[model samples]
Target: MDLLSIKDPSFLKKLSIKDLELLSKDIRKFLIENLSITGGHIGPNLGVVELTIALHRCFNSPKDKILWDVGHQSYVHKILTGRASHFSTLRKYKGLCGFPKRGESEHDVWETGHSSTSLSAAMGMAIARDLKKEKSFIVPVIGDGALTGGMALEALNHIGHEKKDMIVVLNDNEMSIAPNVGALHNVLGRLRTAGKYQWAKDELEMLLKRIPAVGGRVAATAERIKDSLKYLLVSGIFFEELGFTYLGPVDGHNLENLIENLNYAKKTEGPVLLHVITKKGKGYKPAESDKVGTWHGTGPYKIETGVIIKPENTAPAWSSLVSETVRRLAREDERIVAITPAMPVGSKLEGFASEFPDRMYDVGIAEQHAATVAAGLATQHMKPFLAIYSTFLQRAYDQVVHDICRQNLNVFIGIDRAGLVGADGETHQGVFDIAFLRHIPNIVLMMPKDENEGQHMVYTAIKYDDGPIAMRFPRGNGYGVPMDKELKEIPIGTWEILREGEDAAILTFGTTIPMAMEAASELEALGYSVRVINARFIKPLDEEMLTQLFEEKIPVLTIEEAVLHGGFGSSILEFAHSHQYFETVIDCLGIPDQFIEHGGVNELLCDIGLTSEKVVEKVLTLTREKQKRV
Candidate 1:
């Protein structure tokens, strides 16, 4: 049943286009059944089945590297490359990853999670191949929507000038995670409509060919005429002028056409751009109609109906809270413009978009451009809230530092998925933002305890027009805390002490606050009094609270769901060193130096000794050791 594990590689080579078509059907059906049982990317994988089959048929994998951009559409590639049996365990614990992992298979040349990095990577591989005098085709399969990224454009410029023998396959489905945004999407829309003009030109060529000796001369002249006509139909001066030999508006669903075009590109010389048009969800009717990107990444769903099976009694998700809160704020303040790099559905910004369409921007996986654009908007005094995942925000770190923080721009960066995102694993963990952002000057970074506090933090970020601020919030459901009706503007750089104890002070932020409370309760049972402080603002450091805790001779403990290096506790250590107060022992609790693997959040937390029971044990051990010394 699994084509991947078929021992005879010659079987794939012998398969006709008709056989491949049938195989595509089998792959689609298999993907549907497996993904329906175990939640994963259904729409993109189903759409790319034929395209992947055609590519592997034409190109030799492990020799000719086919780099998949973002790796979301790599399920078909995986299914074809000795991983079909693993599809049953997709996105589960100790199962096949949703994205392409290099260690998983030899065919997967690169690991990708975030968008728009493929072009640069492809270029690097191409240049490396050239340097080594190795004959391998470097093909980067990028989505039409991924072209909107500034980095992709930059890479295009370099690759165009280098004139390297690389293939850039533009898989144009007219959608990213959501329907694409900006001028690029508009340009693609016109280019997609140029099918009629292309047909006319093809007919004109056949007419010119009938002129015998003059046919060859007339065909060349007719090609120029077609080029002129192409300009008339839709202007793609973007790709054509970039020195890439533009080919196709080929049907990606058609195996014959895909194989032919791929073979054509393989035989061709330097820098080919093969544009293939595809449907997001080719076979599935329910997913095909989903324009909101709900089918992009999913949990277990009903195959008969397109209904997502949600567990009852789940709290309101943090993403929904942010989107709704932003919408409410925007209703009052017209200057509040919401921005996401590409994710509208993932970030739950559809509610805000529906209410204020013009004010919302889905920048199409261009985080750097979004940051700089927000900076530009801030110069004009517009309140631009750049909502992006913490991991994705890393892509635009330089832009944030140079364009935003340096200018002290009033951009509110609403960082979603701020903690451990389970299942997606190390590539997607949102644990590095605090460590990175804390070092940056003139930027205020804040975190919320729950959904209610997160809403208030949003209110705070929008109202504060002095400088750039980022509010980091975790993934999944909130702590069932009721949201406040009125927005409260808390003072900047302030923290609140929830409980009082002189023996030990527990400083924690965001989702870890509840864990700190639990740990403190356990410590109290062990006859050790513990103090709990909600360290709200990470950047500002709550200096007054720090000074008070230090003066009280209490042993300080910092807990955050971020990296231990250059993070919350590191700041405390830095403060202590500066003030010459090293006597008070401060222990940092967080993700270790090594990369954490995929699992449930709770499982990972306990494994890393961040659980309340572990914390309680550690505290008791430390206290007893201190007592013995006394």
Candidate 2:
């Protein structure tokens, strides 16, 4: 059958096991070919081909809800649910989303990008179903690695206590972006190798019955021996004790086994945890061998050779520059330590970890715990460098505010991907950090214009002893500018004048600085002198420069690659208002009050009018207003 022409998974129920196996091959071929061009969560999707097919065969979707935890592995589900035709435009702007989108298809009942949310969402859906007298199966396919999340554990406890009618599919691939850690992971490791427990339990029960009840003492002894068997044979007793009936260490790749277990789960009363073991990147050779999680998500690649297609001689990634700088400083400063919420590779902290194994901490997927851990480190006069993605940092907002900022601890937060992160879509965009963090007291938020400034900002953040300091950098490579022989710390709250002019001022920082400079140059050609200032420190407004601009009566245009509300630009506006400089004409350009979708960064910038063209237009408009006032 042609994969693209598939309208629904209803046909899957009619197909034989042999035909389903052939269909799985076709689906894998389709994904390997299409994702090689468009690029997506290839490893994850490949791993779930049979599992997804088995699920659709076992359940009636749209009626019986299937929620994918993290949703990166839902590409196979998408293909089966009439979305194979959209593969070419996967993760592109105004096209197919990388994650499950409720608006895209009726089959996609739950949307997810972050991990550990499916169990909680499933609980809510289960409650609603019971309240409405609805009869439908609720299955939440969560990964074993996601189970380590505090929220997932909390939901599990609640789910078991309530005994809601739901099937929790634990897709144990033994990885969540990177290798899973913690005691829960160890428990799963034992389960994975322990094989099926039901057979052993049955044999033990048969032997116990044969032993007979001779007397009260003998009966009690038999009962104790039977209970001890659970400790030895029942690998999933951990979940069983929590009120869920545990099934399998089932083979996820086996269609027959998956279908059988799923059907059993549907028939079972209360909650059931169907543990299905899968291999990440099961089909593709290169992805299957990926130990460091580079193939977890990727750009376009050569499918035959497994070679990633990237631009030649790209500048160092911002993450590497900042992380390496921290590593270098860590050598001199014994007090410095590195911490990440399972993002050592993404944050480029592998070097730091390797160099100072004792000092580096990979705190699994617990962002809240990581934040508080940094605060704890700071209280002991240890400089804790908490490296986290801006989007994930939102999960630890309370910790950042209460534990770190409130006590004014000396913590260095390396906010990676601190702007519009393309390809991962709306959920992974780092545009809200400025809006969320700028309001917190004793928290210094700053971004850098280039890799050189980024390195300096790292130095400044680590050197600053007053309070909690965060330096945000965008995703992808730097501009490849020439570096200085020595590193230096920039003064806090001081804006740098990249280009001096008399007529108007363009204030911006980080990735937006180049756009501002380009716009200023364009204005210069049209006989409009536009001054470009790098307002790097987002929290602390550059008061001296603001006073100068206001005194000169020069109109200001603030540009940021962040949300407009309460962002860097908002800080400038608030400064002008507080200082009583009411006549100063200020225009702002940034991400509008909407979530930006996955696409090329430049395309996203253009869509939101954060390009040089928009800056020129805004500068022209602002200058015209200044002329009118004059």
Candidate 3:
């Protein structure tokens, strides 16, 4: 079967279970092959092949409203819905999105890249469907790991209470990104292994009746015994207590089982939680064996060997450098503790976990709790390093402001992937951290130029006991700069002058520093003396340097890889205005007011006019405009 010929899921209703099984195999093979050339969430998609097939077949999509939580596992859904031909260009520049995009197809009703948002969205849809008096089955397929998120739990509570007509598929792969944590995961584990627990509960009740009760009152006190037995013998008593009709821990790979359960769930009233057990990386050997989430999302790989392709890399990855540095410092600093929200693998914190097992915490998918936990640790005089992706930290903004910033705690926040992450698109990009965090009171935000400076800044953040401080590091490898033998602390709120000039200045930091340097050289060749400054401290503007530049009346250009509005460039603009240096001709350049899509980092930068050529052009214009002012 040519998967590219698939137009929509309507044809699926005509197929038999055996045909669907064959289709699942074909889909798996297609994903494994296509994803080898163009990397994606292969492991997750493979796991959901049968499950997705059953979903589209059992319920009508675009009408019945099937929603994928996180949307990475929607590749099979995409294949069933006429996007297989675009798999070659998947995650490329102007290509098929890595996640569901509403603009791409009518089938993609909701666009999601972040996890644990599906249930809430599904609830909203369900409410709307009822308001309009429309009849449709609302199904939201959420993973077991995402079930641990506070938002997911809150949605479950609300959805269960509301008693909406929906099927909540709990896709239990036993892990999310990394191996799951929390008591909820343990509950799913028991449910996954023991499905006959309800039967055992009935037998236990019969046995309990035969036993003696206090004061021969079996009716009154035995109910308490039944309550205890609910936890012990009822596999899905958790969801049942939450007002949901619990279904089987069905084998997600079995097409017949999945279709049967889904069909039954659709007919059942209120909220039906269909617990489906599936393995992550179901068919592939290497991906299935990946316990550290290496195959969760990946770059290109060799299909025959199952080996991930890579360029020759001498530089350490930013996450590894930051986490390893934290691990190194943890050995000497007993008070230091590390924390992450379901991202130990991505943040490269395995070494830290191994060395300081007692001090390391992986709060499962709960970013809000992770932020406040660090604040709690800081109150007792313990240095806590909260390692979280910039995108995920957005979910915990209130905790950051209310708990961490308000108390003025010594919490060092290592904001991983703090720039335009290319393939994951707008949802995963870390561009908004500076804009979001800089305005918060008593919070210091900064980005380092290279790996060496990053380590020093990490040291600076850990040692600085003033208030909450955060260091931003990009997604991929560093610039391979030589690290210092002894770690040192950079002065707080100070900027580094990379090159000095009189005509014009380029103020930038982190990943954009090299581009600024390149532009400076280009301007110099054209006879314009361009100054380059590493304006690393985003919150605290280099006021002394700004004052000097303003007094000299040098035209300036602010370059950032972040959003221009309310970003580092805006900070510089606010400084010029507040200080009343309105004469300083400042030009801001960065990601314009729009969502950047999936593409190569360089491609995205070029499209957004953040390249060196743009830099040179902007600087030349600023210099020429300044001369005209004179």
RMSD in Å for all candidates:
2.5, 2.2, 4.0
Ranking by lDDT: 2, 3, 1
User: What is the model-wide C-alpha lDDT for candidate 3?
Assistant: 0.90
- lDDT per model vs. reference: 0.85, 0.90, 0.90
Runs in model 1 with CA error above 4 Å? 7-10, 196-237
Worst 10 residues of 2 by lDDT: 211-220
Could you give me the TM-score of model 3 versus the true structure?
A: 0.95
Deviation of model 1 at 420, angstroms: 0.4
lDDT of 3 by residue, 1-630 (tens): 889899999999999988988998899899999999999999998999999999889888899888889689989989999999999999999999989999998889888888899999999999999999999988899998898988899999999999998899999998899999999999888788767443355567777667765435665677687678767766558898998877778898999888877877777889989899999998999999989899999989998888999888999999999999988888899999999999999999999999889999999999999999999999999999999999999999999999999999989999999889999998988888888898999999999999999999999988999999999999999988888989999998899899989898889999999899998998899998888999999878778988988898899899888888889989888888988998889999888888888899999998888899989998888878888888
38-133, model 1: which lDDT tens digit per residue?
Answer: 878888887788888888888888798989995889988887787787777776667788888898888889888877779999999998999999
Tens-digit lDDT track of model 2 for 335-438: 99999998888998888888899999988889999999999999999999999999999999999999999999999999999999998989999999999999
- Scored by TM-score, the top model is 2
- Ordered list by TM-score, greatest first: 2, 3, 1
TM-score of 1: 0.94
